[model samples]
Target: MKSGCQWRMMPKDFPPWQTVYDHFSRWNKAGVWECALDKLNERYRHSKKRAVPSYAIIDSQSVKTVYASEERGIDGGKKIKGRKRHIIVDTVGNLLHVSVHRANINDTKTGVAVFERAAEKYPSIKAFSGDAGYRGTAVTFVEERLKLKLNISTKIKDVFAVLPIRWLVERTFAWLNGFRRLAKYVEILTATAENMIRIAMVRLTLAKLP
Candidate 1:
């Protein structure tokens, strides 16, 4: 995944590409990647003397797709025809959850689902922060329904500045960019795409452990 090498093009001296893909596909469908990320995350947090995250940053990135990819759409705002990766990350830039979907869907419409899913898994999170795109009823849903807070920071016009909290998620996106496979959403299924992201984060967390 780091090299973005085609499965069949993988060099010899390793397990056959078919065997490797078989395990990846099976584990992705079984949520093995998510479990691995969670455990590694716990270990990393403990090593840092940090408790479970109390707040998370949420954002989405739209990327183009291969011609034969499935379930695609155009993000008119971003003017990209592909898919959006909706993700929530902890304050220090650790990814907490990810949801892949059609790019055309507005962030406010589906952003809450990712937050809710993460909240259910990590009940300690008390609030979230995001950009202006996530404004509207989603804010109410977060504060009123879930009884959590959502901070929406509008970008400063005519100037460049990295807004606090929100920048952590942007940085996480930058970290994902280091993995060449994430250069584009190349998976046939959105689930597979999401799993690929989880695997990347798991590898990142492992690097920080003993």
Candidate 2:
């Protein structure tokens, strides 16, 4: 699946395509991928002499999905007809949480949903930073309800200037793009797509550690 090939087109050297796919589905349901990524994150953070992050950065990417995709919508601003991937990453750009949703969804709405989910998984997270897309009343809702600061980076007037904190999540998205499967939203099931992101981050995190 990481190869992003059709199940039937799996290499002959590999196990039967059906068997491989079934195992993958089972692992996703069993939370194997999530657990592995969590361990790798913990180990990597420790290796870097940092505790699990209390602050994170959140952002979303609009990705074009295949024709067969069911959970997709058009992102009018980007003019992309597909799904959006909302992700939160720690200070050093490690995955903290990921949410897949329709492209048409409002960034603030999606941010709320993803942040609520992240709050559950990462209770230590007390603050997060985002771009202008996530600004407005939603920032207050997160702070008052989730008790986490939603720091919105000031919109940069200079195109070349790097915005603090917000840029880290953008870099994390770039790292995810390195995985072929993530170049586009190829997974038919949203859960599978989320797992793929987790798997890619797991590999990247583990590789960073001794």
Taking all chains together, each candidate's TM-score versus the true structure is 0.96, 0.94
RMSD of each: 1.2, 1.4
RMSD of 2: 1.4
Residue 80 miss distance in model 2 (angstroms): 0.3
94 in model 1: Cα distance from truth in Å?
Answer: 1.4
**Model 2: lDDT to the true structure:** 0.87
Deviation (Å) of 40 in candidate 2: 0.7
lDDT of each: 0.88, 0.87
Off by over 4 Å in 1: none
Candidate 1 clashes between residue pairs 3 or more apart in a chain or in different chains? none
Per residue, candidate 2 scores C-alpha lDDT tens digits across 27-146 of: 999999999988888888888888778998988999999988868999999999999999989997789889898899899877887888888898889888888889876697798898
